[model samples]
Target: MPDHVWWKRGVIYEIYARSFQDSNGDGVGDLAGIRQRLDYLAWLGVEAIWISPIYPSPMADFGYDISDYCAIDPLFGSLDDFDVLLEDAHRRGLKVVLDYVPNHTSDRHPWFAESRSSRDNPRRDWYIWKDPAPGGGPPNNWISNFGGSAWQFDEATGQYYYHAFLREQPDLNWRNPDVRAAMHEALRFWLRRGVDGFRVDVMWHLAKSAAFLDDPVNPAYAEGAPDNQRILQVNSTDQPEVHAFVHGIRSVIDEFEDRVLIGEIYLPVERLVAYYGDNLGGAHLPFNFQLIHATWSAPALGRLIEEYEAAIPEGGWPNWVLGNHDQSRIASRVGAAQARVAAMLLLTLRGTPTIYYGDEIGMTDVPVSGEDIRDPWSLNEPGIGVGRDPQRTPMQWSARPFAGFSRGRPWLPLGRDFQTANVETLREDPQSILNLYRNLCALRTEWKALRVGAMKMHRAEGDLLIFERAVDDERLLVCLNLGAEARQAELPAGLGRWRALLSTVSARNAGNNVEFEDTVQLHPDEGLVAVLTA
Candidate 1:
């Protein structure tokens, strides 16, 4: 295994805290439950775990509307429980990365409460507040990410405060030096507690335009979807000033040794790479989210890979994520069979790969009805297929009642196929997606070519996406079939043979030698990682 930068060479598993495991029968997962599952994660061979927010929150936007930065939410556990989770994770050789939300705070937060108390309050500048326009409405045309105007009218103060999402969550005025200092201290408090690192949430929103300018209209905006799509968000996000704030954040995290700082930025490829900073001092990896939102086509994905790789700074590392709490699961997006093929593409790519929890066992999104929906984004816009509760359902750990996630009724419904699609059931099946993930993880540790190799060539041929990763004379080729029908593919060299390291279809064994003069046959939704001499 590579030791210099474990984050760059190792696979990361993202866990949604509320749905991971429920220990105290509360139906909601907590710190203690996560501790009990540490062994399972370590056994799965992930180097690190990026847990969603566990800080004190109002649950308005779930854990994202944090009321306290340094304290653990009672629903999750106490601070002591968090310390134990961290200690146990490190003891098992696994790193723990917390989700850091520096962009906004719950309206119930003391800072926001104090800032909104009165227009003359000392902390009034702590949050963005503006007098109503002459026409008696929002200060600007900015729209809330969750729908409605971004500015909320404060009755007592007679001023409107900005909120990027729900009115219950107010955006912090990061331009204030005090706000910066306080947020930095919040980071230090965790670093002192021995947390490995942080996955900074909305890292690009740390700064906004000083002028409070109205965002230009989005010409591509379509009706009946993405309520905020009417605006392009030119002046509201990815501001030039954000890089400097990111530098300060980088400096603070650099104080601690061997700690990783990851940023969550959702911008185009050209602008996304800017988060790496002028000299690569920004985010260690500013999350390439293209894969999550891109079309699942070999030709489309092939061009995406080349463009993203080309846009990355020379020294900046890259990372890939297939699914997360915010989106639909991979299995549901591209059928169960294709998800296996996706695993090979994600793991073999020339960058760090993050496997969303439950995806390892081919978990699909559980249907969430309107009354059962928990996501604010979905509730704000009904019937738009934007509900996230389907993907945030409880993990299927076993065949036990409620998938063994909780003794009490679960907070959300479990997948209908949890009886067959579970860790315990699939752990014994060599052909299962769970075992496929295990083998791919082991493969990464075994081959340096897949870890730190240069991506020499990548191309799309018909329904197949082919790529090569090479280190010195060691070379590994990854070929994936994106369609449901079998296809014949030609090798670039016209004549070559390689030993199959692993196959998504479970057709090839370790010693199986696949040879071809020019063309090779691939089964439906098949992908393979094969080793050969350079």
Candidate 2:
């Protein structure tokens, strides 16, 4: 591990498209707006900001459908604007990790357009294409992430192309050596431009089963004819050959000191570990989605924490992500009362914590009316509610027009609760959830123990979350009132004098007791952190 890879022990803040800020009054977020927010991010104590894809695209899948990997989309800004944003972010001690979409390319890409134009074109094999079966239909029964057939027929070429996501975005043929080389060149180009790292999109799908074997039927979706339901197995992805390609990518990043690669892999822990490779040269971190699967119950979360701690491979760094642009916001999933607790849990954990943008202000997902939906997933699966549009709404900066996102109408509607959840309103309130996040992040940065300390669950039970974050003899006890009631915990044996470091609610200790009983009556949704003294 390089000593200067700041991301190893730092926090990553995620910024989503069409939501962050609009610079040109186009009702869309652009690089200039992001450039303007660098100081705000620096003050928040995040080490890096991972912006969603800004590559030139047709706006079919937002920015994920890329028409040109190396060019900036006009909707966002020009290439020069991106350069300015990078320079500004670097000056503020903030790293920028761009989202790299290598698994696929938009159908409008010249390469794809040419491939679709003729079956014998040089780029024909660039994308996964096949002749239809004897009946002249899709090559196979594979399903898309948005649902339905994964194959799209091109009458001009009389062949079908594979797309793991939206049909407009065709999956690239990773088996082709030229494709890998080109992708590597693109990565090197960005690194040369001063990008700190890349957040690989759909990393696991980069490799597929060589034989194109049909997947086994999935039993989970037998009940409904739901479009999101997948009957075929994902065996085509997560192939053994993927690591060798990833190793090549790692080699490129390693050449540039301090550069890192974070993969978005949605697989079991055991398989997810493979992304780290045998040596320390694979992806620096494979995002840990345990928080998504973890239930609010103490016993369940406790067991998961233990398992996660034991699963990380040596030499491979660890990272935890609570929310991202693709998923529902944490507040909506865990409830507003639990949001503060979630923040503490993230900051105190053993690995690098990733904070989704707008989470600091407790942003909620907007309800997307079917008629107003733009997500391809939702459009494809109209009845399944599979679209993630609500979660990807424009960020709330203020309660003004377009939620202060743009002078014109926003591409996406602002959250209905923006009046109360805007950043401007929260920034003024010391007790606001946004301030709580700022304080917690500041403490995490100032204290080495909070950054890279060992964590042991003290007494995690129903409606009571307790953990001891320790380094050497210094220990900090974090206790939370998970329920809507007052809670108390008896100081462990050998525990000494303690001082309150931070608390979500007001608290005070009893003057004197031989065996100290640190009882704090907390109001609903309150949590506390006390520095252990000896």
Candidate 3:
């Protein structure tokens, strides 16, 4: 693999800034804290670190509502601290990817403040503002993803401003050339600071319908589903114009050699591939969340992989994700035992894989009660259970007070099992999840087949999932059992012998001396990668 384009062949580890570590004893993680832990990340064998949004904000939506794109939040650290973190990360051979939120900005952002001040203000067009409908309500029936109407009335101006999320976050009018140029400049700002790339937040929401038409009701929406899902969002999101806007952003990223543009798009595989804009003008990797939403069954997962592999554009690369800041932890979604299987599946896939922070140690979601809830979505819709606070809790570094994540109380409570389920304890246990992840990553680096290979589904029967990954002369057979009982997979004719390279049960080389004649047996929830020795 060439070192020039690292993202295509490397695994990405996501670090939620406020929950990673705290250096100032302020209960919130900071850039300085992240900088201090560079050695640990380097040892983890990840090629890059993708930090969640750290821009200056009012803490609305936990920094997604950016007030200043160029400045680092005092809550995270000063700009100088960020520079040091970037320098240190580069020195350790770990590329840094910052979260870029271009869809909306904090209502307090200077541009929004000026735009909302009056109808005739020069910056009024910077944000999506419009006149009320004839009946004196919001301009349209679009609903915010958080809850309630998408439009928030400004008493002073008597017009409503559109927001796809919380009212405090006003969507930018990407149709306006000024807004486009300003956002592009924001990209240049970080590139000038020596950052490697950006993970664009809500890239699909960057453009909306010019007609401001009412979104049609979703026929399949359940009665108790999220209010935003009640509508089909035809006009509000995934518009054709979004592709052009993404191309512009990609152009700006191209100005900086080797820097990547990773768009956060949650569309179907067909539509998702469109973000890889016409060869060279789209996101280098549009995050693929199929595994996150797929059923845990072996057949379901196998079909998803096949569909995703087939959908990629000729030259566009593929990516996979199992967990992230906004979703439930993999350990929670599947059982703790299955999470090991998940780790194996994620790392050995054909394209790049992104590992969520704390997943290496099998971190489960921390319970957050009503009073403890900090997510705007949970607060806005009290009974819906849509809050992301549980998954955004502080990382478990040790058994010490606050899990050694901070000297002070963590911003969010630590998980109940943190004492035993932490990096410190897991690092010492060779059979631990952390060690499994480290071994898998090291193997991926050492083997060309696992790093950059062609994947083909070999079998998907009952609870067993089997596949082959190959590069040039090397071929690997991966078998996984998603069931609670032992399962056997029959090898094809002419596939002579095999040696266990890695297993979820830490049974490496358990069957090294045994030459296969027909079938292989897998223990319950066991997964293994083996080399064909014929």
Candidate 4:
């Protein structure tokens, strides 16, 4: 590993849309708002910030539908605001990685607008288009991630346009050399600016099957999953050709020093590791989401840890992600009592750890009223009860009205109980979860063992979680008592006197006695880290 792999050894805080902070009295969050809060983020001890899509869009998919890949939306702020954001972020030593959606563009995008103008248009091939099938319907039966057929009919062109997500978000024709060149140019524009990296959106969806044959039906979803259960073959989406395109992206990033690329993919471990490319050249890191899937149990987490360690590439940097914009916050996923323990695990894990924006304050998901629904997922899957609105609510900065997020009405409702779960209140209480995160990040930044160490999973028994983080001469043991009652974790032989480094509960260390198996008992939902005293 490079001595200064800035991204590998730091904490990345993710900020979501319509939340964060509103600079424009207009309720929605903008880049200028993020710039104003750069000091707060720097104080939080984060190394970088990963922002969700802020490009110009129709807001059909909440900024994921990019109408213009290179421009900041008027709703968010102007291009000057973005330049200021980049400058301020670098001044504070915080690198910025914006979300890049290359898989598709909004139907309202000029490229698509021109492509769909007429069948005879020169740019018609810029997007995926096909003639209707023999039955005068979609050429192939491929289902959209949201719902229904992936093909949308264009009466003007008398043809069907491919859309992997919403009908408004048409898939770009990557097969077209001009399309690939244009996308590369968009990436270059950002790289030439002071931006450090990119978090590629839905990367695997960029390559489609050349065959364009009808997908095989999914027996598991024969009755069909609640959303859109039409076509089951995701095989058509993730093709081997995708690797070549990712390598091309890597080549572009190679032109700049310290530029990183990360992808959002949720496949099995074997498939997920492939995104790293040959010898760690493709994406710097494909986000590992084990924490999101693991149940809050010692055994479940233990198994996941082992699997993750085994799955990483040789000499490849590993990354751990607890929560992001798409899923529910970790605090809400695991109960409030267990929030601190989750933080300990995240900070101690041997990789770059990403914390969702409001997770430090133990923010819970807000309930969105039926009349206030903004996400398309809810409308697509009305009965299944899965949507992103709850996770994308406005950040709670203070107990004051609007939670200091906005002076006007917010785009989404703010989290309830802001008086208790807010930055202002938690900053005063040293034992608050907010303080725990701050201290953890500080320690992580200072300690090499917890930063770039190799992790070893120790014995996990009877609701006790144990692990070792080691790099060169430094070694530390981490144990967590996840059960309702206090319990002791057995320590390894030859382990001598240990000093308490960080703990959720009181810092009382019972020595490493062989008779007690070098153990210390911890209270319910408590976690502890101890470094060997030489």
Candidate 5:
């Protein structure tokens, strides 16, 4: 808890708890398993770990459908195990961020059960329950994120309750002051337990339109596209009033010392920065997922970076996300070679970087066959190729059976190349993607320019992107070749000499002082970090 914010400079590693490790000889990963792997994470040069949900749940949405806000699930471990894990992580100089799911609660939860038991129940307003339409259909045309109508009819109550993802997960009524106090106490409970921070799940979906209006149809939606995209969700999401609740959450976080609040918002850069709130009262960081959805070309990504850098509020901090449990792995989105380049860019960008679990070792999407699919989103909508099971496969720890993830049968299947693409195997290879990530992370920590300096895009076109990181007189240039063809990039003049610092191409390329020729040549899929010296 230094004066300098750790969230602003530290690299956060996302550990999908289920896929990370299984210490109890069970098929699934647990909190103890994550604690066991802390040494490896410390060696990986990450300063924080953002763990996915381990809260008490019905597992309807893979821990996203939380049943209890203040307790850990028995499947993961008990509260004592969690406290022990938190202590170990903090002892290793790592901050632990929990996934906060406030938008919905499992229908099996006592609160929801009581809310649905009677029409005039005291806690009925805690959940969004609306009367059916005149024609006995859904209240409106709002769609569920998973699929189908957002409303689910309750035969017992003769009403429809709104669930954003699954029918089992009923959306909470954030407008209710009682609900606010309850959720805030949940946050305080964890803060009191010494938990470092929270990454709020579906933060943008917290406040819905009070008027219960129909969303406008999306003209761009096609015939076979996902049902959720059929409408623009103008009325259902990003409501201006959402900020008031977020401000309240910020006030709760401010009560604790040195704790961060990160919102999982998928909005455009314009709206994303707004989560910084009026006078920085909102989320400490509303995740910048633009890189996850961007086209992997140089000019396109460069413009995206420039636009995101420009869109940040005056004093707001920035963050970048390349991959996550929900999105396609970077190695699969771009080619395997370019994932190395992506690692360099992710670490060098003028923002905090959150690295997905297996991405450092160049893990790609492990295809899930018909019989093995576990994601409800895919099971709900079969053949659109939108299943997330591919990305949530077990982490490749070593070349052993089950990729050393577990001794028991894995809950999910391992990747095809699990024997070769693993941390234990790649960590020893100096030229491997894992080492490239280690080196880049080390460089980011070693240089103030890379850690917290201003960034300027010098050249961004075609297959080459060149940017400079500077703080006062200390300067560093980053040159990236995104395509699979070698290209000569023009260098900025009067920057003194270029001393090669780090390269994704090879370990030998670093430390070779490339004399200024007004231009530098880069190999295909190469990214170089060079320091300018007098």
Candidate 6:
């Protein structure tokens, strides 16, 4: 394998801009604050940083509802601040990837404003607008992912516009050539600004069924599922025409040298692999989220890894994500002990891993009361459990007031455990989760077998999961115990001797050379990487 593709062999750290750091005591993280912390990230050893949306917005869906695609929001700072960030990050050898929202725009955007003005407006076709049904109801029974009807009626024009999310975020009509050209131009605008790439938001939802049809009702939806789950969404998402649009976007990205395009797709593994396109023309990485949704068990995770590895198309590189702005933290999902196993699993797997900001220090979800809920999905569809404010709380830097995230009150409340979980506190402890993550990253950088080597499952039974990563004569074994009780894995024939390189249980013979004859015992929730003796 070639050694120069930065995104393929290196790790990427995701920064939720508003929650990362606060400059000027504003309680909101900005480009300036991120620039101030570049040194810390450089020390953490990530090769690239993928920041959440920072475009000019009305804060409807936080920054996802973009009013202007080309400018930075004042809440995050001016365009000059972004330029300095890009320049400084390059100087430190970090590639910057910005979040690109192309499926929809804020209702206040100029295109949406003109499209909603009158029936005969020149820009009326820019957005998806349709007449009400025969009974004066919404055109169809489609439900928004956030909640309620996907159609919002306009009394002035005697029509309704379709929005896949909040009423404030109107879905753009990609069928329109003008809209396509405009969106492509927006991509070019940032490429010229020297961004390394884009993580396209809701990439699969860009194209809809040409024939407007109501989605089929899902028979398996449970009582507590989100309202949107009531329908199968077959007609509204992952349409056949979406691949052509992906190719169009890829064509624009190809104009820039060495830039990557990563898509945020929530489809199944079978459908997700298609986003890579034929001959690798689609997204550079479509983002495999199987691990995030799988059950927290060794058997389930082992099956998921096998399925994902089997699904990748030829010439397509794989990627993995454990947590992000939308999902619950891994620590909260599997408990503190298993989170170390999770870190080892993420870094040791044969793919590029994207680490969420606070995960390195083992941050848990902050509790959000009804009054403090900032996510529109949680507010609109109360009791469905779709709120994201808990996961998007400010980053904890120190044990000072506001967890050293800000001088003023944070936009969202900090977790109660931030005092002990902050970076300052964890950095001093040798066995802390932060140190384990640092060691894992360093191991990936130092060993070719751990970085780009092929992976093969050696043993997977009950709570024990074992895999081998090898390149030519060098081989390494990864053993993880996901259950509460200790387990022993019997060695296979002719495996030779092995030495412990690193262990999740920090005090357990770490970095010690050992010779195993027939079996190796693993503590509960512990993981270890061992090198084979020649």
lDDT against the true structure, per candidate, is: 0.89, 0.81, 0.90, 0.84, 0.91, 0.91
TM-score of each: 0.98, 0.95, 0.98, 0.96, 0.98, 0.98
Can you write out model 4's per-residue Cα lDDT over 1-534, one digit (the tens) per residue? 584688988888899956999988899998888988899899889999998988899999989999998888888887888898999899999999988898899989999889999888888998888999988999988888887788999887789998888999999988788988899889999889877889888888888888788888866674436445555556557788888888888888889889889988877778888999987778888888889988889988888888877888887778888888878888888888798899999999888889999999999888886888888877876656567788888888899989988899999888878877888888888788888899899888767899887788887767888998888888888888878788876788777766777787644432332122377777788888877776
Number of residue pairs clashing in candidate 2, backbone atoms closer than 3 angstroms, sequence gap of 3 or more or interchain: 0
Ten-residue region with minimum lDDT total, candidate 4: 508-517
Model 5 TM-score relative to the real fold: 0.98
Ranking by TM-score: 5, 6, 3, 1, 4, 2
The sequence of per-residue lDDT tens digits that candidate 2 reaches over residues 1-534 is 642358866889999867898888988888998987788899888999999999988978988999988889888888898898898898889999999999999989988988788878898888998889778788667778878788898888788899998889999998898889989998998999999999999889988777777777777766546553556556668988889888888898887978889999988888888899977668888888988767876677777877777788877667888888888889998888788778878877777889999899898888887467988877876866566888888888898878888899887878889988988899998777888888888878766677776788877777777788888777877777677766666556666766666666433322222122355445566776667766
Compute the lDDT for candidate 1: 0.89
226 Cα displacement, candidate 4 (Å): 3.5
Residue-level lDDT tens digits of model 5 in 267-381: 9889989999999899998999999999888889889999999999888888998999999999999979999999999999998899999999899998897788899999998
For residues 341-409, write the lDDT of model 3, one tens digit per residue.
999999999888999999999999888985788999988887777889999999999999999999998
Which residue segments of model 3 deviate by more than 4 Å? Answer: 1-4, 507-517
lDDT, candidate 4, equals 0.84
How many clashing pairs per prediction, in order? 0, 0, 1, 1, 0, 0
Runs of candidate 6 exceeding 4 Å displacement: 1-3
RMSD of each: 1.5, 2.6, 1.4, 2.3, 1.2, 1.2
What would the per-residue lDDT of candidate 1 be over residues 1-534, giving only the tens digit for each residue?
Answer: 143588988999999999999999989999999999999999899999999999999899889999999999999999999998999999999999999999999999999879988888899999999999889999899998888899999999899999888899899888899999999999999999998789999888888889989999988888987878889788778899999999888889989988888999989999999999988888888988888898899989998999999998888888899998888999998999999999999999999999999999999999989567788888888887878899999999999998999999889899999999999999999889999999999999999988889895556857899888888788888888999999887777632566667888867656566644345678899997888732
Candidate 1 stretches greater than 4 Å from native: 1-3, 494-496, 511-518
**lDDT (0-100) at residue 296 of candidate 3?**
96
Pairs with backbone N, CA or C atoms under 3 Å apart (clashes), candidate 5: none
